[model samples]
Target: MKGFFSLPGERLFHVATLSALGFLLLFFVGIISSLATYTDWRQFFSILFSKEILFAIRLTLFTSTMATIISMVFAVPAAYAISKTNFRGKNIVDTILDLPIVISPIALGAALFVFFNTSLGRALEGNLMRFVFEVPGIVLAQFTIISALAVRLLKATFDSINPRYERVGRTLGYTKIKVFFKVTLPLARNGLIAASILTWARAVGEFGATVTVAGAMKMKTETLPIAIFLNLAQAEVERAIAVVFVLVAIAVIALVILRRFTSRRQTS
Candidate 1:
Protein backbone atom coordinates (compact mmCIF):
# COMPACT_ATOMS: atom_id res chain seq x y z
CA MET A 1 0.00 0.00 0.00
CA LYS A 2 2.36 2.73 1.25
CA GLY A 3 5.21 2.47 -1.25
CA PHE A 4 6.60 -0.92 -0.18
CA PHE A 5 7.86 -0.26 3.39
CA SER A 6 9.29 3.17 2.57
CA LEU A 7 10.03 3.98 6.23
CA PRO A 8 11.95 0.75 6.73
CA GLY A 9 13.90 1.37 3.50
CA GLU A 10 14.91 4.83 4.72
CA ARG A 11 16.07 3.35 8.03
CA LEU A 12 18.08 0.70 6.18
CA PHE A 13 19.74 3.35 4.07
CA HIS A 14 20.72 5.34 7.16
CA VAL A 15 22.07 2.20 8.82
CA ALA A 16 24.20 1.36 5.79
CA THR A 17 25.60 4.89 5.60
CA LEU A 18 26.44 4.90 9.29
CA SER A 19 28.14 1.52 9.01
CA ALA A 20 30.34 2.82 6.16
CA LEU A 21 31.28 5.89 8.18
CA GLY A 22 32.14 3.68 11.19
CA PHE A 23 34.41 1.53 8.99
CA LEU A 24 36.21 4.63 7.70
CA LEU A 25 36.69 5.89 11.29
CA LEU A 26 38.14 2.51 12.24
CA PHE A 27 40.59 2.70 9.34
CA PHE A 28 41.90 6.10 10.42
CA VAL A 29 42.17 4.98 14.06
CA GLY A 30 44.16 1.95 13.00
CA ILE A 31 46.64 4.14 11.09
CA ILE A 32 46.95 6.51 14.04
CA SER A 33 47.57 3.62 16.44
CA SER A 34 50.25 2.16 14.19
CA LEU A 35 52.01 5.50 13.95
CA ALA A 36 51.66 6.00 17.70
CA THR A 37 53.61 2.77 18.28
CA TYR A 38 56.72 4.49 16.98
CA THR A 39 56.68 7.19 19.66
CA ASP A 40 60.45 7.40 19.96
CA TRP A 41 60.47 11.11 19.13
CA ARG A 42 64.28 11.30 19.06
CA GLN A 43 64.65 8.32 16.76
CA PHE A 44 61.82 9.55 14.54
CA PHE A 45 63.45 12.97 14.17
CA SER A 46 66.80 11.39 13.36
CA ILE A 47 65.31 9.29 10.58
CA LEU A 48 63.20 12.14 9.28
CA PHE A 49 66.12 14.57 9.15
CA SER A 50 68.65 12.11 7.74
CA LYS A 51 70.24 13.16 4.43
CA GLU A 52 68.88 10.22 2.48
CA ILE A 53 65.31 10.83 3.63
CA LEU A 54 65.63 14.52 2.91
CA PHE A 55 66.89 13.79 -0.60
CA ALA A 56 64.02 11.38 -1.16
CA ILE A 57 61.49 13.97 -0.07
CA ARG A 58 62.96 16.60 -2.38
CA LEU A 59 63.09 14.25 -5.37
CA THR A 60 59.51 13.09 -4.77
CA LEU A 61 58.14 16.62 -4.66
CA PHE A 62 60.10 17.81 -7.71
CA THR A 63 59.26 14.87 -9.93
CA SER A 64 55.61 14.85 -8.88
CA THR A 65 55.21 18.56 -9.62
CA MET A 66 56.92 18.24 -12.99
CA ALA A 67 54.84 15.22 -13.87
CA THR A 68 51.64 16.99 -12.88
CA ILE A 69 52.51 19.98 -15.08
CA ILE A 70 53.39 17.78 -18.04
CA SER A 71 50.20 15.76 -17.57
CA MET A 72 48.06 18.90 -17.60
CA VAL A 73 49.76 20.21 -20.71
CA PHE A 74 48.62 17.19 -22.65
CA ALA A 75 45.45 16.42 -20.72
CA VAL A 76 43.74 19.75 -21.34
CA PRO A 77 43.72 19.49 -25.12
CA ALA A 78 43.07 15.75 -25.09
CA ALA A 79 40.17 16.10 -22.68
CA TYR A 80 38.57 18.98 -24.57
CA ALA A 81 38.92 17.16 -27.89
CA ILE A 82 37.39 14.01 -26.51
CA SER A 83 34.55 15.81 -24.79
CA LYS A 84 33.63 18.10 -27.70
CA THR A 85 34.13 15.96 -30.71
CA ASN A 86 32.82 12.71 -32.20
CA PHE A 87 35.50 11.16 -34.29
CA ARG A 88 36.21 7.91 -36.01
CA GLY A 89 37.51 5.44 -33.41
CA LYS A 90 36.65 7.91 -30.67
CA ASN A 91 35.85 5.08 -28.28
CA ILE A 92 39.12 3.40 -29.12
CA VAL A 93 41.02 6.62 -28.58
CA ASP A 94 39.34 7.14 -25.23
CA THR A 95 40.12 3.57 -24.16
CA ILE A 96 43.75 3.92 -25.16
CA LEU A 97 44.00 7.16 -23.20
CA ASP A 98 42.53 5.32 -20.21
CA LEU A 99 44.85 2.29 -20.53
CA PRO A 100 47.34 3.67 -18.00
CA ILE A 101 44.59 3.87 -15.40
CA VAL A 102 43.41 0.35 -16.14
CA ILE A 103 46.83 -1.30 -16.52
CA SER A 104 49.07 -2.09 -13.57
CA PRO A 105 51.71 0.59 -12.93
CA ILE A 106 54.33 -2.15 -12.76
CA ALA A 107 53.39 -3.33 -16.23
CA LEU A 108 53.48 0.22 -17.55
CA GLY A 109 56.96 0.67 -16.15
CA ALA A 110 58.03 -2.64 -17.59
CA ALA A 111 56.78 -1.52 -20.98
CA LEU A 112 58.83 1.65 -20.68
CA PHE A 113 61.86 -0.42 -19.78
CA VAL A 114 61.30 -2.62 -22.79
CA PHE A 115 60.75 0.38 -25.04
CA PHE A 116 64.13 1.83 -24.12
CA ASN A 117 65.66 -1.37 -25.39
CA THR A 118 64.03 -0.91 -28.78
CA SER A 119 65.74 0.82 -31.76
CA LEU A 120 63.76 4.08 -31.60
CA GLY A 121 64.00 4.15 -27.84
CA ARG A 122 67.70 3.55 -28.08
CA ALA A 123 68.00 6.38 -30.61
CA LEU A 124 66.10 8.71 -28.30
CA GLU A 125 68.22 7.60 -25.38
CA GLY A 126 71.36 8.17 -27.38
CA ASN A 127 70.29 11.57 -28.68
CA LEU A 128 67.48 13.32 -26.88
CA MET A 129 66.32 11.50 -23.76
CA ARG A 130 67.59 8.70 -21.60
CA PHE A 131 64.76 7.31 -19.51
CA VAL A 132 65.75 3.86 -18.33
CA PHE A 133 67.14 3.68 -14.80
CA GLU A 134 67.58 7.45 -14.66
CA VAL A 135 65.96 10.54 -13.18
CA PRO A 136 64.12 11.11 -16.43
CA GLY A 137 62.77 7.61 -16.07
CA ILE A 138 61.16 8.60 -12.80
CA VAL A 139 59.43 11.59 -14.38
CA LEU A 140 58.39 9.54 -17.39
CA ALA A 141 56.93 6.83 -15.19
CA GLN A 142 55.02 9.26 -13.02
CA PHE A 143 53.83 11.14 -16.09
CA THR A 144 52.66 7.94 -17.77
CA ILE A 145 50.55 6.94 -14.79
CA ILE A 146 49.26 10.36 -13.83
CA SER A 147 48.39 11.69 -17.29
CA ALA A 148 45.68 9.11 -17.89
CA LEU A 149 44.01 9.99 -14.64
CA ALA A 150 44.38 13.68 -15.36
CA VAL A 151 42.75 13.22 -18.73
CA ARG A 152 39.84 11.38 -17.13
CA LEU A 153 39.37 14.12 -14.58
CA LEU A 154 39.71 16.93 -17.09
CA LYS A 155 37.32 15.26 -19.51
CA ALA A 156 34.69 15.18 -16.80
CA THR A 157 35.31 18.87 -16.19
CA PHE A 158 34.97 19.72 -19.86
CA ASP A 159 31.85 17.60 -20.12
CA SER A 160 30.24 19.52 -17.29
CA ILE A 161 30.59 22.82 -19.18
CA ASN A 162 27.56 23.75 -21.24
CA PRO A 163 27.94 23.83 -25.03
CA ARG A 164 25.39 26.64 -25.34
CA TYR A 165 27.78 29.06 -23.70
CA GLU A 166 30.31 28.45 -26.46
CA ARG A 167 27.57 28.85 -29.02
CA VAL A 168 26.63 32.18 -27.52
CA GLY A 169 30.24 33.33 -27.64
CA ARG A 170 30.40 32.33 -31.30
CA THR A 171 27.29 34.36 -32.04
CA LEU A 172 29.08 37.27 -30.41
CA GLY A 173 31.83 36.86 -33.06
CA TYR A 174 34.30 34.97 -30.92
CA THR A 175 36.17 32.08 -32.50
CA LYS A 176 36.16 28.63 -30.90
CA ILE A 177 39.65 29.08 -29.52
CA LYS A 178 38.77 32.50 -28.16
CA VAL A 179 35.56 31.21 -26.67
CA PHE A 180 37.45 28.33 -25.03
CA PHE A 181 39.97 30.66 -23.45
CA LYS A 182 37.58 33.44 -22.50
CA VAL A 183 34.53 31.49 -21.42
CA THR A 184 34.96 27.73 -20.98
CA LEU A 185 38.32 27.78 -19.24
CA PRO A 186 37.22 30.50 -16.83
CA LEU A 187 34.11 28.47 -16.04
CA ALA A 188 36.15 25.30 -15.47
CA ARG A 189 38.75 26.95 -13.22
CA ASN A 190 37.67 25.12 -10.07
CA GLY A 191 37.61 21.78 -11.89
CA LEU A 192 41.09 22.43 -13.28
CA ILE A 193 42.39 23.16 -9.79
CA ALA A 194 40.81 20.00 -8.41
CA ALA A 195 42.25 17.90 -11.23
CA SER A 196 45.73 19.34 -10.68
CA ILE A 197 45.57 18.56 -6.97
CA LEU A 198 44.40 15.00 -7.59
CA THR A 199 47.05 14.40 -10.26
CA TRP A 200 49.85 15.79 -8.12
CA ALA A 201 48.82 13.69 -5.15
CA ARG A 202 48.73 10.54 -7.26
CA ALA A 203 52.07 11.37 -8.85
CA VAL A 204 53.69 11.95 -5.47
CA GLY A 205 52.53 8.57 -4.20
CA GLU A 206 53.45 6.61 -7.37
CA PHE A 207 55.83 3.75 -6.65
CA GLY A 208 55.66 0.61 -8.75
CA ALA A 209 56.34 2.30 -12.08
CA THR A 210 58.98 4.65 -10.76
CA VAL A 211 60.85 1.81 -9.13
CA THR A 212 60.67 -0.41 -12.17
CA VAL A 213 61.89 2.23 -14.63
CA ALA A 214 64.07 4.34 -12.36
CA GLY A 215 65.58 1.53 -10.23
CA ALA A 216 65.59 2.70 -6.60
CA MET A 217 69.23 3.61 -5.98
CA LYS A 218 69.68 5.20 -2.53
CA MET A 219 69.89 8.96 -2.89
CA LYS A 220 69.83 8.80 -6.70
CA THR A 221 66.43 7.43 -7.68
CA GLU A 222 64.90 7.00 -4.24
CA THR A 223 61.49 8.63 -4.00
CA LEU A 224 59.53 8.73 -0.77
CA PRO A 225 57.73 5.47 -1.45
CA ILE A 226 60.93 3.82 -2.63
CA ALA A 227 62.66 5.10 0.49
CA ILE A 228 60.02 3.44 2.60
CA PHE A 229 60.46 0.19 0.70
CA LEU A 230 64.25 0.22 0.95
CA ASN A 231 64.09 0.98 4.65
CA LEU A 232 61.67 -1.87 5.32
CA ALA A 233 63.83 -4.23 3.27
CA GLN A 234 66.71 -3.58 5.69
CA ALA A 235 64.46 -4.07 8.75
CA GLU A 236 64.45 -0.34 9.37
CA VAL A 237 60.80 -0.48 10.31
CA GLU A 238 60.91 2.73 12.32
CA ARG A 239 62.42 4.69 9.44
CA ALA A 240 59.95 3.16 7.01
CA ILE A 241 57.00 4.03 9.21
CA ALA A 242 58.38 7.52 9.68
CA VAL A 243 58.43 8.00 5.93
CA VAL A 244 54.91 6.59 5.82
CA PHE A 245 53.80 9.19 8.32
CA VAL A 246 55.50 11.91 6.31
CA LEU A 247 53.57 10.77 3.24
CA VAL A 248 50.36 10.67 5.27
CA ALA A 249 51.02 14.19 6.48
CA ILE A 250 51.65 15.40 2.92
CA ALA A 251 48.39 13.82 1.75
CA VAL A 252 46.44 15.30 4.65
CA ILE A 253 47.80 18.78 3.97
CA ALA A 254 47.06 18.55 0.25
CA LEU A 255 43.50 17.37 0.95
CA VAL A 256 42.96 20.21 3.41
CA ILE A 257 44.18 22.77 0.89
CA LEU A 258 42.02 21.28 -1.83
CA ARG A 259 38.97 21.36 0.45
CA ARG A 260 39.58 24.99 1.33
CA PHE A 261 40.15 25.96 -2.30
CA THR A 262 36.96 24.20 -3.39
CA SER A 263 34.98 25.75 -0.55
CA ARG A 264 36.19 29.23 -1.44
CA ARG A 265 35.40 28.69 -5.10
CA GLN A 266 31.91 27.49 -4.19
CA THR A 267 31.30 30.49 -1.96
CA SER A 268 32.64 32.96 -4.50
Candidate 2:
Protein backbone atom coordinates (compact mmCIF):
# COMPACT_ATOMS: atom_id res chain seq x y z
CA MET A 1 0.00 0.00 0.00
CA LYS A 2 2.80 2.43 0.92
CA GLY A 3 4.76 1.60 -2.27
CA PHE A 4 1.69 2.06 -4.39
CA PHE A 5 1.07 5.56 -2.98
CA SER A 6 4.73 6.49 -3.39
CA LEU A 7 4.68 5.41 -7.06
CA PRO A 8 1.69 7.68 -7.78
CA GLY A 9 3.34 10.62 -6.04
CA GLU A 10 6.56 10.10 -7.98
CA ARG A 11 4.64 10.01 -11.25
CA LEU A 12 2.80 13.20 -10.34
CA PHE A 13 6.11 14.96 -9.54
CA HIS A 14 7.59 13.84 -12.87
CA VAL A 15 4.53 15.08 -14.78
CA ALA A 16 4.66 18.47 -13.03
CA THR A 17 8.37 18.94 -13.85
CA LEU A 18 7.79 17.93 -17.47
CA SER A 19 4.86 20.32 -17.78
CA ALA A 20 6.98 23.25 -16.51
CA LEU A 21 9.78 22.41 -18.90
CA GLY A 22 7.32 22.04 -21.76
CA PHE A 23 5.97 25.55 -21.16
CA LEU A 24 9.50 27.01 -21.27
CA LEU A 25 10.35 25.09 -24.41
CA LEU A 26 7.12 26.21 -26.03
CA PHE A 27 7.89 29.88 -25.32
CA PHE A 28 11.28 29.74 -27.06
CA VAL A 29 9.86 27.68 -29.94
CA GLY A 30 7.18 30.31 -30.50
CA ILE A 31 9.81 33.07 -30.72
CA ILE A 32 11.92 31.07 -33.14
CA SER A 33 8.87 30.31 -35.26
CA SER A 34 7.92 33.96 -35.47
CA LEU A 35 11.44 34.79 -36.51
CA ALA A 36 11.33 32.07 -39.16
CA THR A 37 8.10 33.47 -40.65
CA TYR A 38 10.18 36.05 -42.49
CA THR A 39 11.46 33.56 -45.02
CA ASP A 40 12.48 36.28 -47.51
CA TRP A 41 16.24 35.77 -47.52
CA ARG A 42 16.77 38.96 -49.51
CA GLN A 43 14.89 41.15 -47.04
CA PHE A 44 16.63 39.43 -44.15
CA PHE A 45 20.09 39.90 -45.64
CA SER A 46 19.35 43.52 -46.53
CA ILE A 47 18.28 44.42 -43.01
CA LEU A 48 21.19 42.49 -41.53
CA PHE A 49 23.64 44.48 -43.60
CA SER A 50 21.94 47.85 -43.17
CA LYS A 51 24.28 50.60 -41.98
CA GLU A 52 22.08 51.51 -39.00
CA ILE A 53 22.09 47.95 -37.72
CA LEU A 54 25.81 47.60 -38.38
CA PHE A 55 26.43 50.75 -36.35
CA ALA A 56 24.14 49.51 -33.60
CA ILE A 57 26.04 46.25 -33.55
CA ARG A 58 29.30 48.11 -33.20
CA LEU A 59 28.03 50.47 -30.48
CA THR A 60 26.33 47.70 -28.50
CA LEU A 61 29.45 45.56 -28.55
CA PHE A 62 31.71 48.46 -27.61
CA THR A 63 29.61 49.84 -24.72
CA SER A 64 28.80 46.42 -23.30
CA THR A 65 32.44 45.33 -23.40
CA MET A 66 33.59 48.57 -21.86
CA ALA A 67 30.98 48.36 -19.11
CA THR A 68 31.90 44.76 -18.29
CA ILE A 69 35.63 45.46 -18.19
CA ILE A 70 35.16 48.56 -16.04
CA SER A 71 32.74 46.73 -13.75
CA MET A 72 35.16 43.86 -13.29
CA VAL A 73 38.00 46.22 -12.49
CA PHE A 74 36.07 47.50 -9.47
CA ALA A 75 34.07 44.34 -8.81
CA VAL A 76 37.06 42.07 -8.24
CA PRO A 77 38.47 44.16 -5.42
CA ALA A 78 35.08 45.08 -3.92
CA ALA A 79 33.94 41.47 -4.01
CA TYR A 80 37.11 40.27 -2.29
CA ALA A 81 36.75 42.88 0.40
CA ILE A 82 33.09 42.11 0.97
CA SER A 83 33.73 38.38 1.07
CA LYS A 84 36.92 38.27 3.18
CA THR A 85 36.43 41.09 5.62
CA ASN A 86 34.05 42.08 8.39
CA PHE A 87 33.46 45.71 9.21
CA ARG A 88 30.91 48.04 10.77
CA GLY A 89 27.69 48.54 8.80
CA LYS A 90 28.62 45.67 6.50
CA ASN A 91 24.97 44.79 5.99
CA ILE A 92 24.23 48.37 4.95
CA VAL A 93 27.09 48.24 2.53
CA ASP A 94 25.83 45.00 1.06
CA THR A 95 22.35 46.43 0.62
CA ILE A 96 23.78 49.52 -1.11
CA LEU A 97 25.73 47.30 -3.46
CA ASP A 98 22.51 45.51 -4.34
CA LEU A 99 20.45 48.65 -4.90
CA PRO A 100 20.71 48.53 -8.68
CA ILE A 101 19.46 44.92 -8.82
CA VAL A 102 16.60 45.71 -6.47
CA ILE A 103 15.48 48.91 -8.19
CA SER A 104 14.02 49.01 -11.69
CA PRO A 105 16.50 50.04 -14.36
CA ILE A 106 14.20 52.75 -15.69
CA ALA A 107 13.86 54.21 -12.24
CA LEU A 108 17.60 54.06 -11.81
CA GLY A 109 18.04 55.92 -15.08
CA ALA A 110 15.51 58.52 -14.07
CA ALA A 111 17.36 58.95 -10.82
CA LEU A 112 20.59 59.47 -12.71
CA PHE A 113 18.92 62.01 -14.97
CA VAL A 114 17.64 63.87 -11.95
CA PHE A 115 21.06 63.68 -10.33
CA PHE A 116 22.63 65.54 -13.19
CA ASN A 117 20.54 68.56 -12.33
CA THR A 118 22.10 68.82 -8.90
CA SER A 119 25.07 71.12 -8.16
CA LEU A 120 27.64 68.35 -7.88
CA GLY A 121 26.28 66.54 -10.92
CA ARG A 122 26.18 69.79 -12.88
CA ALA A 123 29.74 70.56 -11.86
CA LEU A 124 30.89 67.10 -12.95
CA GLU A 125 29.01 67.46 -16.22
CA GLY A 126 30.71 70.81 -16.90
CA ASN A 127 34.23 69.54 -16.12
CA LEU A 128 33.92 65.90 -17.15
CA MET A 129 32.41 64.31 -20.26
CA ARG A 130 28.81 65.09 -21.11
CA PHE A 131 26.42 62.19 -20.45
CA VAL A 132 22.86 63.39 -21.01
CA PHE A 133 21.55 62.13 -24.35
CA GLU A 134 25.07 61.19 -25.37
CA VAL A 135 27.14 58.09 -26.16
CA PRO A 136 28.77 58.33 -22.78
CA GLY A 137 25.33 58.06 -21.22
CA ILE A 138 24.99 54.62 -22.72
CA VAL A 139 28.16 53.50 -21.02
CA LEU A 140 27.17 55.18 -17.77
CA ALA A 141 23.73 53.57 -17.76
CA GLN A 142 25.17 50.16 -18.58
CA PHE A 143 27.88 50.50 -15.96
CA THR A 144 25.43 51.60 -13.28
CA ILE A 145 23.06 48.71 -13.88
CA ILE A 146 25.61 46.02 -14.70
CA SER A 147 28.27 46.75 -12.12
CA ALA A 148 26.02 45.69 -9.27
CA LEU A 149 25.43 42.38 -10.99
CA ALA A 150 29.13 41.94 -11.59
CA VAL A 151 29.88 42.64 -7.95
CA ARG A 152 27.18 40.21 -6.82
CA LEU A 153 28.43 37.45 -9.09
CA LEU A 154 32.05 38.00 -8.09
CA LYS A 155 31.21 38.10 -4.40
CA ALA A 156 29.63 34.67 -4.78
CA THR A 157 32.74 33.50 -6.61
CA PHE A 158 35.03 34.84 -3.91
CA ASP A 159 32.87 33.32 -1.21
CA SER A 160 33.21 29.86 -2.77
CA ILE A 161 37.00 30.11 -2.70
CA ASN A 162 38.70 28.76 0.41
CA PRO A 163 40.09 31.53 2.56
CA ARG A 164 42.72 29.19 3.93
CA TYR A 165 44.64 29.59 0.67
CA GLU A 166 45.00 33.31 1.33
CA ARG A 167 46.17 32.61 4.87
CA VAL A 168 48.67 30.10 3.53
CA GLY A 169 50.10 32.69 1.16
CA ARG A 170 50.28 35.26 3.94
CA THR A 171 52.12 32.81 6.13
CA LEU A 172 54.67 32.46 3.33
CA GLY A 173 55.42 36.19 3.81
CA TYR A 174 53.16 37.51 1.04
CA THR A 175 51.27 40.79 1.47
CA LYS A 176 47.47 40.80 1.17
CA ILE A 177 47.63 42.20 -2.36
CA LYS A 178 50.25 39.69 -3.41
CA VAL A 179 48.33 36.82 -1.85
CA PHE A 180 45.08 37.85 -3.54
CA PHE A 181 46.67 38.17 -6.99
CA LYS A 182 48.61 34.93 -6.67
CA VAL A 183 46.18 32.68 -4.80
CA THR A 184 42.62 33.99 -4.68
CA LEU A 185 42.45 35.46 -8.18
CA PRO A 186 43.96 32.43 -9.97
CA LEU A 187 41.39 30.16 -8.34
CA ALA A 188 38.58 32.58 -9.21
CA ARG A 189 39.61 32.89 -12.88
CA ASN A 190 36.75 30.75 -14.17
CA GLY A 191 34.24 32.67 -12.08
CA LEU A 192 35.65 35.96 -13.35
CA ILE A 193 35.26 34.80 -16.95
CA ALA A 194 31.71 33.64 -16.31
CA ALA A 195 30.89 36.93 -14.58
CA SER A 196 32.29 38.94 -17.49
CA ILE A 197 30.19 36.95 -19.99
CA LEU A 198 27.03 37.44 -17.93
CA THR A 199 27.78 41.13 -17.37
CA TRP A 200 28.32 41.78 -21.07
CA ALA A 201 25.08 40.01 -21.95
CA ARG A 202 23.18 42.03 -19.37
CA ALA A 203 24.74 45.27 -20.58
CA VAL A 204 23.97 44.50 -24.20
CA GLY A 205 20.37 43.69 -23.44
CA GLU A 206 19.79 46.69 -21.17
CA PHE A 207 17.03 48.78 -22.70
CA GLY A 208 15.19 50.80 -20.07
CA ALA A 209 18.19 52.63 -18.65
CA THR A 210 19.85 53.00 -22.02
CA VAL A 211 16.70 54.35 -23.61
CA THR A 212 16.02 56.72 -20.75
CA VAL A 213 19.55 58.05 -20.40
CA ALA A 214 20.89 57.89 -23.92
CA GLY A 215 17.64 58.64 -25.82
CA ALA A 216 17.16 56.29 -28.80
CA MET A 217 18.54 58.67 -31.41
CA LYS A 218 18.61 56.10 -34.22
CA MET A 219 22.17 56.07 -35.55
CA LYS A 220 23.44 57.99 -32.53
CA THR A 221 22.46 56.34 -29.23
CA GLU A 222 20.63 53.35 -30.68
CA THR A 223 21.68 49.94 -29.37
CA LEU A 224 20.32 46.60 -30.61
CA PRO A 225 17.48 46.57 -28.07
CA ILE A 226 16.63 50.20 -28.79
CA ALA A 227 16.77 49.47 -32.49
CA ILE A 228 14.28 46.66 -32.04
CA PHE A 229 11.98 48.99 -30.08
CA LEU A 230 12.29 51.74 -32.68
CA ASN A 231 11.58 49.39 -35.57
CA LEU A 232 8.64 47.79 -33.84
CA ALA A 233 7.20 51.21 -32.98
CA GLN A 234 7.45 52.20 -36.64
CA ALA A 235 5.66 48.96 -37.68
CA GLU A 236 8.77 47.56 -39.40
CA VAL A 237 8.25 43.99 -38.28
CA GLU A 238 10.81 42.37 -40.55
CA ARG A 239 13.57 44.73 -39.51
CA ALA A 240 12.63 44.37 -35.85
CA ILE A 241 12.61 40.62 -36.15
CA ALA A 242 15.99 40.64 -37.84
CA VAL A 243 17.45 42.71 -35.01
CA VAL A 244 15.81 40.38 -32.53
CA PHE A 245 17.57 37.46 -34.17
CA VAL A 246 20.89 39.24 -33.83
CA LEU A 247 20.28 39.83 -30.11
CA VAL A 248 19.28 36.20 -29.70
CA ALA A 249 22.38 35.05 -31.51
CA ILE A 250 24.63 37.13 -29.26
CA ALA A 251 22.89 35.83 -26.14
CA VAL A 252 23.04 32.22 -27.28
CA ILE A 253 26.73 32.52 -28.14
CA ALA A 254 27.56 34.04 -24.76
CA LEU A 255 25.58 31.37 -22.91
CA VAL A 256 27.17 28.57 -24.89
CA ILE A 257 30.67 29.87 -24.25
CA LEU A 258 29.97 30.33 -20.54
CA ARG A 259 28.51 26.82 -20.25
CA ARG A 260 31.49 25.22 -21.96
CA PHE A 261 33.93 27.19 -19.84
CA THR A 262 32.09 26.25 -16.64
CA SER A 263 32.00 22.56 -17.65
CA ARG A 264 35.72 22.57 -18.42
CA ARG A 265 36.50 24.27 -15.14
CA GLN A 266 34.48 21.73 -13.20
CA THR A 267 36.17 18.82 -14.94
CA SER A 268 39.62 20.23 -14.44
Best by TM-score: 2
160-267 per-residue lDDT for model 2 (tens digits): 988898899999999998998899999999999999999999999999988988898999999999999999999998898889889999999999999987897788
- Model 2 lDDT on a 0 to 1 scale: 0.92
Where is the poorest 10-residue window by lDDT in model 2? 1-10
Give the poorly placed runs of model 1, Cα more than 4 Å off.
1-9, 264-268
Q: Write the per-residue lDDT of candidate 1 for residues 1-268, one digit (tens) a residue.
A: 6655698888998999999999999999898777777767779999899999999999999999999999999999899999999999999999999899999999999999999899999999999977888899999999999999999998998998889999999999999999999999998898899899989999999999999999989999999999999999998888898899889889998898889877876786
User: Could you estimate the TM-score for every candidate?
Assistant: 0.94, 0.96
| Residue 230, model 2, lDDT | 97
| Model 1 whole-model lDDT (C-alpha atoms) | 0.92
lDDT of each: 0.92, 0.92
